[model samples]
Target: MAVVLLLLKTVGVLGFISLLIFYLKKIRLYRAAAKFPGPPALPFIGNAHVFVGSTEDILNKIMELLDTYPSPLRFWLGSRLFFGVCEAEQLKIVFTSPKTIEKEDLYKFARPWLGTGLFTAPASKWRVHRKLILPTFNPRILESFVEVFAQQSEIMVRQMKVEIDGDEFDVFNYISLCTLDIICETAMGVTMKAQTEGDPTYVESAKRTFEIFYTRMFKVWLHPDIIFNNTRLGKDQRECIDYLHGLTNDVIKKKKLELTFDSPIIEDTKPRKAFLDLLMELSNEGKKFTDEELREEVDTMMIAGNDTTASVNSFVMLMLANFPEVQEKCYQELCTIYGANINTDTVITHEDLHRMEYLERTIKETLRLFPVGPVLVRYVSEDLDIGGHVLPRGSSVVIGILKMHRSEKYWKEPLKFDPDRFLPEEVAKRHAYCFVPFSAGPRNCIGVRYAMMAMKTLLATVLRHYILKKDRTVRIEDIKLKADVMLKPVEPISVKIERRKH
Candidate 1:
């Protein structure tokens, strides 16, 4: 009895001490965060309730917070301090700082699917992998991908004829599959033919995984592994990840067999070397990446490269449809580059892509209004100052890309969809960081050039074949957006297309 009582007393004392230390840390965090403006937080929850509704509701709440608070707005997610920085100057500080290179803890939710691929890898791993993969996106190499982009885009344009002259239909489904096909061919040196074959299992699994990840990101209860593993969503995520991994592994296996020690270089005769093939050549040259690492990168390319491009192209299509005059201008630009008879079969060369300056501006404008990545989360490794405010070390920062893009302070008549906003004169007048759909800094997206090239080629192809249209009644303001693995419309991006009457 004496021994049991003594153990209980010790345990009780330790628990008290732990709680005391936890509160002390929390109090300090509160003091540090109190310097910035944000919504009042409740104990323990700490503004978590703000993220508790449907993804659309959560987006609205976030936007509401951005509207109410000033730049470098402070908010807490549980005990973690999050500063929402939307102003260009503040964004520049967070993005360019070496201390903020690491991604925030929230990205861990994607690790089960993405592994430690470039998307979810730690700063140390990311630095090395990014360097290795950087050469693969060389302009010369990306130029070779023009053929693949044109071919896949032609397929997408042909596939969409079914929607011709019909009521508005969701274009994302078609666009996503097309991008999946393009990424698979370019990333893995294999053809997925996702568009021609309807939806593949890998495609379905990946989509489901993204949805699950978005759900887990906001639901705090799903953060713990033990608890999450026991739930249905967790089980579903496991199944999806397994399928995705299997597909990537199979591709890697076949490529490894084909790549022998004798021929370290893939023949120039091949239309183009896939990103995977380049990595394999490097591995063959002795800078070896494990089979698992190869899978991580290929999967990352598939998910990151495919989804963002698809979303941007889809949104651009919708925007073009809504503003017929903008669509006509883009078509006119395409005509100037590809000639008046530009049709579904027209091939877009790399030079042609560069010449479509107006189309490029339209794409940029769409990205500004509806960037696929609405927010980028970074971990502050050291104390940082922005706009006379201190963001303490160990806390996180949310670079509010969406809010910043739409902020009236940076953009005049911000809500208007004016491609002219990207004209050289206007762009030069604004701060450099004012528009960052691909993020900025040392850790900025490695695939920016690749993504832009793919988007331009795809858009040029589609526009050549069809005139995109949308209900003028459907204003941009009515488009409800949701936070997924990417930012997407709550409802599908519905638009109508008609065979171009030349």
Candidate 2:
């Protein structure tokens, strides 16, 4: 009885100490976050309760908060504090600041699927990898991929021919397949045949992986690996990641074999080197990347190269379908550029892509409405001042790109879908950081030029062949937005397609 009483007393003392540590940490967070305006946070839990619901609902809540709160607001997720910045001035500071370059802790969730690739790697590693890969995207090299983009787009145009029967269909899925095909060929130097073959094992696994990862991001209970790895979601995530890694590994092995036996002179004759070929060359020259590192980068490129361009292309088509005048303007521009060749089997030259100014504006406007990354998150390594608010070290800051793009202060008629908003004169008038579909500053998207080439090629090619028409029932406002790393329309974007008479 005396021993039992002693054990109980020890337990009581430990509990008291635990409570003391919790409150001490809370006090520190409260002191740092107190200066900023935010929703009231309860003890221990903070504002975690505010994040309940489906991903769509959660995004809506965030948008509402953006509308209600002033810039540089504090958001507490349990005991962790995150500063949300939406205004251009604040975003400039966050994006350009050297100290805030590391990705937020939330990105660790992707490590299982993407590995420590460029997206998930530390700033130091990312800087080195980024430099090594930069040469692969030089203008001359990108120009070589034009043929790949054109070929893939031609296949897409052919596929759309069967669907042009006055029935509306989801355009995003088809475009996604085409983009996947492009990435597979350009990044891995393999033909996935995603559009022609339907959903392959790798494609399906990737889709599931992303869906599960997004789900885990909201369900905090699953954040612990011990708990998550035992659940069905965890099991599925592991399986999907294995398949994805296997696919990338296979591609790497095949490329390495080709490099070993193939003659360098023959390789030199090729029109353009694939991204893998460049990496292999670097490896052969002693600037090596481990097999694991190569896999990580391949996965990163596959994800980055496919989704962002596909989303933009799909959104652009939706916009063109809804806005007939804008569509007509784009068609006219194509008519002028392609002229007699508009309806002919003509190749799109690099110069032709350069001449697509108006179509470029439409793409920019679509991005403003739905930037691929709705929020750009970064880890604050040191205490910093942002728009008059102090963000303590170890905190995370999220630049609300979607909010800033649509904010009334920067955009006139913020909700209106007007392509001319990106005209050179108009763009010059606005804050430079106000519209960053590809993000900005030192760590900006390395594939911006590549993405633009792919998007412009697909869009211009499609417009040349078909007239895009919106589903009669779908309105601009009816399309709900959801954030799953990338922002996407909740409902499939269905459009009626008609063959254009040359």
The sequence of per-residue lDDT tens digits that candidate 2 reaches over residues 1-502 is 9999999999999999999988786676678888889899887667778777767876777777787888888887766788888989888888999879998888889999888888888898999999998898899989989999999999999988988857889898789899999999999889999898887576567767877777676566677899999999899999889888888899899888888888989888877778888888887888578888888988999989998898889999999988999999999999999888898779888889999999999999999988999877899999888766778987888788999988889998887889999888999999999998888988899999999999999999999999999656355566799887788888888899999996
Clash pairs (backbone) in predicted model 1:
none
TM per prediction? 0.95, 0.97
Best by TM-score: 2
Candidate 1 lDDT over residue span 327-382, tens digit each? 99998888777675576465789999889899999999999999978977899999
Alpha-carbon local distance difference test for all models: 0.87, 0.86
Looking at model 1, residue 435 earns an lDDT score of 95
In lDDT terms, how accurate is model 2?
0.86
| Backbone clashes, each candidate | 0, 0
